[model samples]
Target chain A: MKKLTKDDLQAIKQEELKKETANWIKVGLSTCGIAAGAQDIYDFLVEEVKKRNLGVSIQRCGCAGMCYAEPLIEVKVEGMPKVFYGKVNKETAMKIVEKHIGGKILVNDHIYDIRSSQ
Target chain B: MQQKRILIKDTDLKKDRTRDFYTAFLTEIQDKKLEEKVQLVRVSDIGIYGKGLTVRVLPENFLYCDVETGDISRIVSESVVEGRPIEALLHKPDDKQLRLVLRNCGLVDPESIDDYIKHDGYQAIATILEKMTPEKVIEEMKISELRGRGGAGFPTWLKWKLTRAVEADQKYVICNGDEGDPGAYMDRSVLEGDPHSVIEGMMIAAYVIGATKGFFYIRAEYPLAIERVNRAVTQAHEYGLLGENILGSSFKLDIEIRLGAGAFVCGEETALISSVEGKRGYPRPRPPYPSVKGLWGKPTVINNVETLANIPLIMLKGGKWFSSIGTEKSKGSKVFALTGKVKNSGLIEVPMGTTLKEIVFEIGGGGIAGKKVKAVQTGGPSGGVIPEDFINAPVGYESLQKLGSIMGSGGMIVMNEDDCMVDIAKFYLRFCVDESCGKCAPCRIGGTQLLHLLEKISEGKGEIEDLDRLRRISRAMQKAALCGLGQTAPNPVLSTLRYFEDEYKAHIVEKKCPAGRCAGLFHFSIIEEKCKRCGLCFRNCPVQAVSGNRDQGYLIFEEKCINCGRCFEVCKFEAVSRG
Candidate 1:
């Protein structure tokens, strides 16, 4: 935790960007997302990932603004399109892990928004 | 084989043909035996509204709108099976949204400074500390033409220049996060979703104004925003971005958080300055605006959360580049908390001067639950409503002001046909009345008087003269009221009266609520033919308004009915009617 100078910023950013070793799931943890039971989904994903000994890392992010379909979770498993699953719950969370992660095919009816802009 | 994907959704509001369309597409895929190679998924929404069924084929990014069942087989063979798009069915959509202020929001982890840094977070401040002068910073801001997103649309660079011109040793900068507008949570979302960007904006301001101390004024209502901001500030301090010699430069600045006590008036700059100084949030007249004398009699620059969030980007990218997006007067982008009666109620960032129609229909996916959008209320209580006709007007400071509304804090509540204009005016006026500090007589009394007149109108007791009375009181409140709260409190009433004066006349002269929102003016009656005698309306009635059971069929007696509209909601047969 050193006081970062201007020179260290680029190196730090580059290092952090390169640190992505495994697939990750970012759950919307903002107030709106949290209110829509995103916390439960995040906890479920973490427990399930650990229980199943999966290589997926569950992390927290803020609201993506599409709040109508919350408990929103974005899955970025290898070889699958990065997409957002809305109205997510424990059941949907399990399906996402079992289907999108293990099976490599996107779960139907749960995809709320695809990252088309990116 | 190349992996192909197709995303489909039924864009029709009345019926969901997605299941039928899904089966047809599945049958086509199975017939071709391309089930594994081509994965067709049913999505909840394909981001396209009202163009019938929408099908988007992936990898090629081909979209086909209004696809019938006959066209599905062709779509599968050409787009899905062969990876070639049908030229006639290939629909091109004009996406009218552009995200700049919300770039890192929801994308980056708010608590992690590293995540923000990777997204080119504090690069603006680092660049400023290394090269740009205070004057140069202000010049860049002026070039961007970024007015404050905090309702009033005051130019950001001018505020800085004014504060910088005043020769004060102990200058302060405040970030106005006390967003008290109803139906607006853009500030809270930004603070919670991307705390470091705002910090970077504030740091850039501190550098520009040479301010030694800064305050982040967030309302106590947003605990998570407060927590994230507190973390962001602590992170900035640890990284030498705040609290003495920031970024190894000679400039030294410190930022601290001040919690607002949930007062709406605190959103005003003067009152916000007073609140930060530990006083009751009462606004004083401007002679000495915050730019000249603010935060303990020292020169200060207060910026709204969105305005500050835009600063870091403006500093990183050149000001000319930023100004190229919006209209002549308003520049860059605006983030709106699109709520109330919209299908996709969420945070949407569009370029400034984007039409309200584009926002409601294109980005928001139109009105919620098959209802037509009657009006769009922007700028919260202090601002006015833009009726359906004027929704095509570009949403800038001047354009919205011309349409009798201001872009107040980017809270655009898309109202449906069921919402009464008079009722909406009364709701905003009531909020103003309740949140009024009661410092001045015109605001204190005139606001209450306006509310009373509106209340009278809604209850079928209003006279034609009461409309004139409302106008008189609104004018007085606008002119004589001490602060923005009282001055702008009459906007919703005045604007509604301007556009929907016929409705007001109907309320006063005809004694009939056109939208049927005002309960006293309307009564409940059951249409006998439409009534299935399901006892739903009878069971849902709070009072014993209907005596008949399922065998006899229910009847709403005019005497006992309270006009609550509960029966209308519960009746699946559309039996319960109100007029």
Candidate 2:
């Protein structure tokens, strides 16, 4: 890789943040998340997404501070609002992939928070 | 699709019907003939506590507290439809938490170098390496007025200046990441969340102090943080930021990771340095401080993880800007791990001078299960307990210190009425005793004696004279101990005794644990009047302590009862009495 000039660094940053990608899922991958079996959930989601040929992009991030409720998975579909699901296991991860991602319906009881575009 | 939002909360604290709150909300929303347009959603947590009914409207984000059936129309019509706030019932809650150290935590990918650069990460290092002189950097730090976050409130700039003044061919900068305070993980979170920012901070420190070698002293408990930091350092080296000349500058620095063996005492500077040198982790007397003689007899500058995290921001935003955020002496925000009986127990960063009330109620969403807050324990095991009466005191270094607590690594544990002061002190002292290196006399011997006395008092076997004995020993340990481990270990016991001596008196004179925490002081009995012959308690009890049939009703055999409180916990009806 070439040495990044000031403008090059600025452009790279802008480009990374520029894309307004819809339909994405982020799983907490911190120590808390790992303890709560987030790695299993992450692997299950990745495998299911590939098998089903889903368009949603799966990503990994750090802890969102709510550690008591870990294996925390956040799902956001194109037109649907973003929701954080707490205490998520493999079953819930599959349910999220099937319902929240494939279908537009939201599963109850596991939802922690819901946020709109505003 | 029409942008309708409703927040539901169980306002009645006298009884718990939090589960039934959703049904009531659904019924109310359906009565308005607007159930289709408005989606009735159940939130796992609503950031408000103790209020009866809390309803919020989306997009506008207008909140109404203590909402009733009569006011539901006004909420649905004016706020939801018209997008206007209700003036009378509006809750103007002040959020105390200011997020300084944890500004980017959970928001950024820690392992990615590009992601770190995206948030103006390396700009500080570039600015420092290109233009600023070592003296100027140290001057800026002095102007910033940042006290050490690793307790004691030592001026960070003065530490750097002293190290810079020491003449040595080779110097070192070490980031102290060996955080071992109970209920405190603020450092771990920052390192795991934003690894590059701290690396950049350390790099800046290296440049300013003219040190070519730096060490990241992290505890073994945080494996993930170590992994991410190791990856970040390797990437920095690959990009010519760590090894040799970086960004066409002649200054060169190399960083290494040193794992601590998970000893609480190793957090002390002397002990930490000793541990890094592959020697015993016991602290020696500090006449020639680490700034003068450190790491292989060379001058070294050691800074806490949270302290180093602030350096990048200080450089990016001018030091003056960084200095202006806090109070007169203490500057910038503090990241507190708000745990133990807090509603939303998570990481909160509030600016200095923000009150404990605001942190406990506004940002932390009040006490756990809407129970009244009894006391807040700050600064971890080495810190003291601040009672509910002084919740209004602003959280600056001097203010907390005045309340008999030092801001030690920001572990803020909120306690409810269920917590006993004596029990709390005993817990902390027990923790110190367990982690004590046993190298020195005051810590090794005094700590064990204190724990034994506390245990005896809790078990209904103590005299009033023990209180005077506790004070005497605590003083001796504080003044004569070899390191901070012994010096501050008695803080919790001393502070609790000073503030809540009446509780200790009750333990000693009345032979009662007021909070029902001590097993010896409490008794388990099956209330014959309340028992409905369900026999659930008898079946659930680990020990078959409950006797008698439905005809005679249930009676607890006190001798057989181990008092695990399993009978109290499993009984659906309030049939078991514990005193």
TM-score of 1: 0.98
Q: Per-model C-alpha lDDT, please?
A: 0.89, 0.83
What are the DockQ scores of the candidates, in order? 0.68, 0.45
Candidate 2 Cα misplacement greater than 4 A, ranges: A1-8, A18-23, A48-54, A74-85, A89-116, B1-38, B82-86, B89-94, B548-552
Report the CAPRI category for model 1. Answer: medium
Report each candidate's C-alpha RMSD, comma-separated, in the order given: 1.6, 3.0
* Backbone clashes in model 1, listed as residue pairs: none
lDDT of 2 by residue, B1-579 (tens): 464656555444423454455566666668877777666555555556668767666656677778776776677778776778999999876555566667666656787887777778688888887789989988899888988888878898898889888889999999999999889988888888788889988998888777999999999999999999999999888777778777767878999999999899899998989999999898888968989998888999899999999988888887898889989988998888889998778777889988999888877778876679988999988999999999998988999989998778899999987898889989999999998988899999999999999998999998999999999999999999888889998999999998899889999999998888888998988777788888888888888888877677788898998988888988888988898
The C-alpha TM-scores of every prediction are: 0.98, 0.92
Q: What is the C-alpha lDDT profile of model 1 across B93-145, one tens digit per residue?
A: 87677888888877898989888888997888888889989999999999999
Off by over 4 Å in 1: A116-118, B13-16, B557-560
The local lDDT score (0 to 100) that residue B162 gets in candidate 1 is 88
